[model samples]
Each structure stands twice: as C-alpha cells, then as structure tokens.
Target: MTTLYSLYFSLVHAFVGLWLTQIINRRPRLLGTWIAVFCTNVGLILSTAVYEQTGSKSAGVAAVAMVWVYNGAFFLSCSSIFFTAYANPVAMRSIGWKLYRFYTAILVVTGILIYFVIVETRGYTLQKIGELFDGKRVHLWVKSPVDDKESDGPDDGEIRA
Candidate 1:
C-alpha cells in the first residue's frame, strides 16, 4: 500500500528502468533492451498520470485483454527478476537478503493480484496500456491547449469555449 505513494513509484520505476536498461543493453536480445527502455521511460509517465487520476480508465473488454497480456507479462517478468535478485546470496549479503526478499515478494504479489482482481483502473495501474492508447508525442515539455469544438467558442448558446 505504501508503494502507492507517488515518490515510491517514481523512484522504484526510475531505478528499475535504469538498472534494466543497463543490464539488458548488454544482452543479445534487442526485445529486452527495447522493452526495458519503453517500460521505463514511457511507462513511468503513464503510471504517474494514471496513479494520480480520480476517474480511472474504463475496463472495457479491449482494455481487459490488453492488461491481461501486457500487464501480466510485465509483472511476471519483473517478479522473475526480483526473485532472482532476492535469492542471489551476493546481492542479498550486500543488500540484506531477508528484508529484500520480503519486500520483493510483497510487491510482486501485490502487483499480480491487483492486475487480476481490480477490474477498473482504480489503483490498478498498467501504465503501458494507457500509453499505448494515448500515443501522442510532443518534443518539448510545454502545456498544450485543449481543443474547442464550437466554431464561435462560448459566444453561442452552446456555452463551450
């Protein structure tokens, strides 16, 4: 539950992304490299927004299918990596294996359960799916104006500016 906090998500995901990118980059598999970078950079942003939203993404059948594949795969893959690090004596000796394994299991299990149980996007954040749909990219980081549907703006009785 504490992991729901904004800073925790940002820090963990950022660090994970960096770690994965570094490790995966050395691997022969380009998919891992791409997925790591994609999940980290774009995934981070989407998770941030979804995590902050009040009205969550609708759990339409399409969205559900997307979550099943993408979210399921991601969390499973991440858990595999996490359990490895936890089970590694060298990594654990340096980073306290017992505590790390406890946290790792908690996180991975929580993520898996949330993905399956939560139908709505409430606390269920597979930011990648949202990013896949809202796939617009602007170079710079400036705010953009929302579109006005009315031709003459709020001047008409329609009252939409």
Candidate 2:
C-alpha cells in the first residue's frame, strides 16, 4: 500500500514536471522569472519523490543515482532563488547585501527546520495548523490583506466612503 502510494506520487510529480516544462518552453517571455522559479520547484519535487521511492527499497545503484539527482535539484532550486534576487540589481542596491544575506539565511534555516521539524497536517483543520505556527517564531508567515483604498492608488476613481 505504501509502495503504491509512493509510486503514484512519483508518477504525478513527473507528469507535472513534464507538463510545466512544455508550457514554459512554449512561452519564452511571459512571466519568465516566475516560470524559472516554478520549474526549479518542480524539479526539486520530482527528484525528492523519486529519491524517497527508490531509497525506501533495498540499497542499489538506482537509489544512489536518485540521491545524487535529489541533491542537485535541491541546490538548484535554492540557487535559483538566490540568482533571482541577484538579478534585481536595483533592489540589491537599495536594500543592501546585508538584508539579502539575512533573507537568504532565513530562507535556508526555514527550509531546514521545515524538513526536520514540521509535522504532517494532512488531517488537521486549517485553524489547527494556523495555531501551530501562530507565535513569534512564525511571524509574517501569514500575509495581511491589502486595504482596498491603498491598492486603488490615487488616480483609479473608486470613490472612498
């Protein structure tokens, strides 16, 4: 049963990767930054799923190969995020490297903690999961809604009440 579930997930991951890659390749310019991010994330997901499925079985060359692929995909995804930030020279200049360094450190630490510490909330209610992260440690995890007036800007003629 567990093996079947793993195989199913692996197939689904591969399918999603192939579908998204086709779409991304078709549209070379539209949302290129986000498309790169999405493709990297899909690669990470596909590799991780394949690694888990292979590693659960007896150790062999296939398992070793999957591990290598998973490690490469993981680092590639992380580096894509960094490279995206690096490409934004104006933001880098205004915000400074210290801020970017801090952001990257936070991202890395969060990823590590999530992989090690986070529990599966598969059956939990939304409120239950929200409560789990509703502390100083999880600050800014949930976004505040944007006020209509603020989003409307000065020229867009939606009259304020």
Candidate 3:
C-alpha cells in the first residue's frame, strides 16, 4: 500500500538520519532536533505545496523521493569508500571489520570538525542560515544572531486572552 511504503520510508529516513547524525556530529541530540524540523518542513510542507501547485500527485511523490534518494546515496557512498579501501586488503579481515574501521574514522574526523569548524545554531532561526554562506566564516561555538529571542509569536500590540 502507498501508506505503508510512505510510513516505511519516513521511519527509515528518520532513524537512519538520526543514527548518522549521532555518528557524524558532536551534538547528536541538537542535530537530531534540527533534522526533525528540516524533514517536516521540506518533506511534508513543501511536498504539499508542490502537489497543490501542479495539481498532480506525481510531483509531490517526486519531491519526497528526491529527499530519500539523496539520503540513501549519501549513506551508501560513505560505506563504499571503506569498501574500496578494503577491496584488495594488505591485511585480510572480514568485511564487517572493514566497515567498523571506516565508521570509527568517520566518527573521529566528524568530532574534530564539529568542534573546530561547525557553528552551533541550536534555537536559532532558520531564516538566517543564509548568513552562514555569506563569505563570512562562522567558527564553532560562536553566538548565533538569529536566536529564539526574536519571537515568531503575535506582536506585542495584539490583544491576548
């Protein structure tokens, strides 16, 4: 059933992405939160808009498929790197062992990169994410300008119950 396939892929994407996030990032929980927010906006909201705009279910399906395919390819590519490294091993070992070494290396490198290079934008507005690429280098642990203090709620001028 379509519903079943959708559910399956959603779960796969969420869990796999979460697992990979834990492996690759310094703050797994924070990154996981961002991933959830990202998926909801891009996966559900954007796809719905596409379906409405084109009046075709296929367009929406394609959008969802694109997200899944991209993630799947990323995961596979990481594994393939290790696979190739062990293709003609100088030291023989099980394929599982090769994968383990690859993942450990990835974890270590990711941790160093996150600590030194990646900025912490937890609780920040996604709108200012563009500033990350505005030719200004943002280092890890720098304070974000788009903090949650800028409320998205109703203006103070509005009456509250």
Candidate 4:
C-alpha cells in the first residue's frame, strides 16, 4: 500500500507542484495564493489517508511518503509567500517593525502547528501518536483475549436468594 500510494502521489504531485510554482512566478494573484494554501491542506489529507490505511505495513515507507507529500506541498506555499515578500518588501516595511515582528512570530507558531498536524501525525496510529507505524495503539501491546474465555461460561456459580 505504501509503495502504491507513494508511486501514485509522486506522479500527481509533480504536476500540482509545477502548476503552483508557475502560478506564483508568472501570474501572481491573491486567489492563487489562497488556492495554494488549500492545495497544501489537500496534499496533507491525501498523505494522511494513505498512512491511516497502510500504517501496519512499513514504517519507513510511510514516513517517506508523509515527508514527500507535506514538505513538497509546504515548499510550494512558502516559496510563493517568500516570493511575494521579495516582490513587495516595502509593504512589509509600511506596517512598521513591531508589526513585522508580530507577523514573524505568527509565522513561526503556525509553522510549528502545521508541521505537527501534517508530518508528525502521519507515521502514527489513532492511539500511539508519538510513535510511528506501530501495529497496536502506541507500545501498549494489548493482546486480545482468546475467544474461548467468552464461550467458557457466563458464570461459574450463580446463587439467587
């Protein structure tokens, strides 16, 4: 599953990636930026869905796919952001240094959150969020009880008084 998803997305990712890069490069629009942001989210979702379905398969492959999808997508948006900033650094200056500082702070905070959301959770299960690609929830090693126990008896002795 990992190999299949990776192979499929990698091909699709290139076309999308190039489209975004050109959009920011040749024809820049606010709408395009918004679309790029949405595309980033879409990319994250695709990679995540694949991970969830195939988490039990291979940890390393899952990690690679997540990184590939996320970093590639985020790079598109960040590159566009930086390009816009480069094009109009004067606009940033107009807001004053304090606002610029605030802007930078927000970027850092949001970047961290985005990384956690997209990348960190990719190689994990619904329960073991910290670890990557474990079959069970985290390292709990919860062994399912044998079926014989249920069929053994409802109760060994039951006295009704």
Query: Which candidate achieves the best lDDT against the true structure?
Result: 3
Better of 3 and 4 by lDDT: 3
Residue 74 lDDT, candidate 2, scale 0-100: 34
- Give one digit per residue, the lDDT tens place, for model 1 in 21-83: 455432222234335433443433344334335334542333334323343334423422455
lDDT (0-100) at residue 109 of candidate 1?
59
The segments of candidate 3 whose C-alpha lies over 4 angstroms from its true place after superposition are: 1-98, 122-127, 135-161
- Cα-based lDDT at residue 54, candidate 2: 65
Model 1 stretches with alpha carbons more than 4 Å out: 1-26, 30-37, 59-79, 82-161
TM-scores, all candidates, are 0.20, 0.22, 0.27, 0.22
Candidate 3 lDDT, tens digit per residue, 28-99?
543443343344334444554566577677867865675455344334213223453356354324452243
Clashing residue pairs in candidate 2, if any?
Answer: none
Q: Model 1, residue 125: displacement in angstroms?
A: 45
Q: Give the per-residue lDDT digits (tens) of candidate 4, residues 1-161.
A: 97576556555655565676554442232234334444444444454445556664554355445456444554444432344436435754565223333434555566555544433343334454434444343332333376433232223221123
Which run of 10 residues does model 3 get worst, by summed lDDT? 73-82
Candidate 2 lDDT by residue in tens digits, 1-161:
96465445445545555555545441232233233434444443454345455653433444444434443333332322345436657764665333334444544565555555655454445545565657322222323376433333224322223
The runs of at least 3 residues in candidate 4 whose Cα sits more than 4 Å from the true structure, single-residue gaps closed, are: 1-77, 86-90, 120-161
